[model samples]
Target: MFKKAFFAGIPVAILCLGLLTGSCQSTGTNKRDKEGFTAIFDGKTLQGWEGDPTYWRVEEGALVGEITPTTLLKTNSFIIWKGGTPADFEFKGSFRITTDGNTGINYRSEQLTDIPFALKGYQADIDGKIRYTGQNYEERGRTTLAYRGEKVTVNTQQNAADPESFRANVKNNAWQARQVTGSLGSSDSLQTFIKSNDWNDFHLIIKGNRLLHYVNGKLMSDVTDNDTVNRKMQGLLGVQVHVGPPMKVQYRNLRIKQL
Candidate 1:
């Protein structure tokens, strides 16, 4: 009777062992798709993401972010990711503006938080004047207002500098696609560009600290890692809803492919 009982339980033991080993590895990581890529946003919900829930929404099949009056979405503080090392790859998504201007997104972030990072890293920008498109700030990044001495000048040429340039490019608030390919260099230096009206694609290749920002298939910002100390950038991927009039925006088809 004892021998018969032990033999009968063999199949059950094998199944249990398989279940335990399978779950352990996938719990902290994502499997690559058949296209040899792994998707970040699931397209329907904010799974594998944690942050100020008030900052984002999943509405009518779109991943949305907005700025509420008297509210700091702090969407620019963290990224929702599958468990894995921050991989260097191409990030692409479709977006539409629905607010009172001033909006941007961050990439190649090292972590998540509200503290200023000095000469630590860089953020790829998204500027839609009616929705805060191309304005890059050193939010806990290397550049601080207090540290800007007497003759320091802020660079605002990345996203047309003003609304007129933004309005002239967008057509009746249409949906536009944007992309950033972060290719780091051996040194950890970086730079990025933007595209708004057109279905523009920017390729960012980061090989270590070295980075590049290509806009609408053009080289816009070619900067390197300068140990000069600019805090507020780099650390975690985040979306920014500037302190301004209330606004809303929609995004979809978000995908990431490691290179």
Candidate 2:
């Protein structure tokens, strides 16, 4: 009976679809999405990375950065990847953070001369709380370039000031030379898509003056830096452990595809 056989296969087809849904949600990106990307982390060791030994380590197949009360940091620190600088690229990684933890991925960034393992450049902001997550923050640079759900273009200033001075100016006036061109969604509404106290997928697509940050397949922030004086074309890549309460963050399956 052809009709009876087709109907019997329905339950099996539904079971296979359910299994796939769980797999994709658990890992964020599926195997097909990672086809061209190469894994930077080996899932077993910190082989090609450099950071303060006191804070970073490889644990449970992930690159882990933890700050204990006794080992709290006065300044933010980073674990830099010793790979080639990628100018135009797509990076995908999965991260999990503690309730109070703050961390980010820095690309097209420069390591500071005075502070070891310190970087200054555009950062894909991530925090245990979803408040600042999915934002584009220029750490030790222009500060907040674009908050979640914002699409902006940063214009150049006549006098290119240092990061500290720019921060001071923002504190006084809460202003920068950035113009909000569009909106992706409300910041509060976007948070509903992010998982709490669990692993989340983060993707950064950087090309020329444009940068995009996505979380769990949702585009959260988009920024275009028209300021040639302060923008970086290419530089180092690193992950940070912020200067705050004792906290922990882990990154796994770091893969990149250079465009």
Best-fitting candidate, measured by lDDT? 2
lDDT: worst 10-residue window of model 1: 1-10
For model 2, where is the 10-residue window of minimal lDDT? Answer: 1-10
C-alpha RMSD by candidate, in order: 16.0, 14.3
- Against the reference, the lDDT scores of all candidates come to 0.40, 0.81
Error of 1 at 20 (Å): 23
Cα miss at 94, model 2 (Å)? 0.2
TM-score of 2: 0.84
Q: For candidate 2, lDDT tens digit of each residue in 1-259?
A: 0011100011121223322222222132222343666566777777667788788888999999999988888889998876556688889999999999999999999999887789998999999988899999988877888999999998886666675656554642223878999999999999998998999999999999999999999999999999887899888899999999999999998987667
Tell how far residue 79 is off in model 2, in angstroms: 0.1
Question: Residue 237 deviation, candidate 2, in Å?
Answer: 0.5
